[model samples]
Target: MPLSAGPHVVVLVEGRSDAAAVAVLLRAHGLDGEGRVKVVSMEGVTNVARDLRKSRDEHPDAMVLGLYDVAEERFVLGALRRAGVPLEAPVDLVDHGFFVCDSDLEDELIRAVGTAVVEDALDEMGHLERFRTFQYQPEWRHRSLTDQLHRFAGSGSGRKVALAERLAVRLDATTTPPPLAGLLGRIAQHLHP
Candidate 1:
């Protein structure tokens, strides 16, 4: 599974949710991501170095982009630095085709669409009642609505991935969170530049 054999660029993400979100954004912006870009989920942020090495080894000339949580910026930066990308700051990472989510992809989406809209999305997806039940739990009851929503999404198996796909589809280019927008723009530049 050489990335170079299939696509012009690779977008490495922390997990499936990030992959799904990136794919949806690329498609929303009119790029044939499935055909032209390879989105790989390293499965965890800690695997950045291993994944980057593998992708580069397999596709020496293919552009590599990444989306990661801000909490994992150090790991991503260290990996990039080891790979010879001279990044001095988070913004510098963006210039090199890596974007960091503020807290994580879920947080970014919640902020982009707002709690009300996300609640509506949950309601539409038939998860609103489940979410409400989770919120009423003793430990969760005191947390902020946003925090509850974030936890609820990650609590259930595959819920984060499912919600990410739905949320990404509901977002347009204008409302896309900054990190996601930057990642897509970086990919577009690589594809068209």
Candidate 2:
């Protein structure tokens, strides 16, 4: 049942945080794709094109899915094209089993779960006051609290990944971020089909 030993789905994500977020959600949903679904972190969006190619080459029979930031859509789309997917536009991503985050996964979760909920989660993690300090920085002081939260979470994948797991655990069907939720559903279909 190892990922490399059977039929599986290969997920290409931008970073560990993206990987962490999706993995946590998948488990929470009881998808149990550990052996059949692999989440591959390319570590950066810039590597999408190359990573996509490599993944397909390595697992030609596996379904390849991806989650990418809006700012990095070009890279994902370019990668899809290079992979021989007939993508006509960004919306076409979902049809190909890829999803785009508005800005990034952090932003999508923050917006879906809310700034206050995230702050509460930070408080539970004993990092609320520290996040308060982060918010007071000159560069972030004037931004919206949600924007500050995104920046704070994006500061490190450690925090981002931890928060993603925490938030996803608290997320019910109504609160799950569209991309993450959609990705989970896709994973389910792939495994069950």
- CA RMSD of all predictions: 2.9, 2.6
Q: List the pairs of residues colliding in candidate 2.
A: none
Weakest 10 consecutive residues of candidate 2 by summed lDDT: 1-10
- Score every model by TM-score: 0.92, 0.90
Residue lDDT tens for model 2, 1-193: 5334654888999998888888887787777644677789999999998888888888888889999988888787787788777876435788988898998888888888898899999998888998999989999999999989888886854888889877777788998888888898898887876
lDDT score for residue 131 of model 2: 94
lDDT string for model 1 (68-180, tens) is 99889889888988988777543567767888898999999998888998888889878999998898999999999999999998888888888998889988767899998
> What's the CA error at residue 46 for candidate 2, in Å?
1.1
Pairs that collide in candidate 1 are none
Model 1: worst 10 consecutive residues (lDDT sum): 1-10
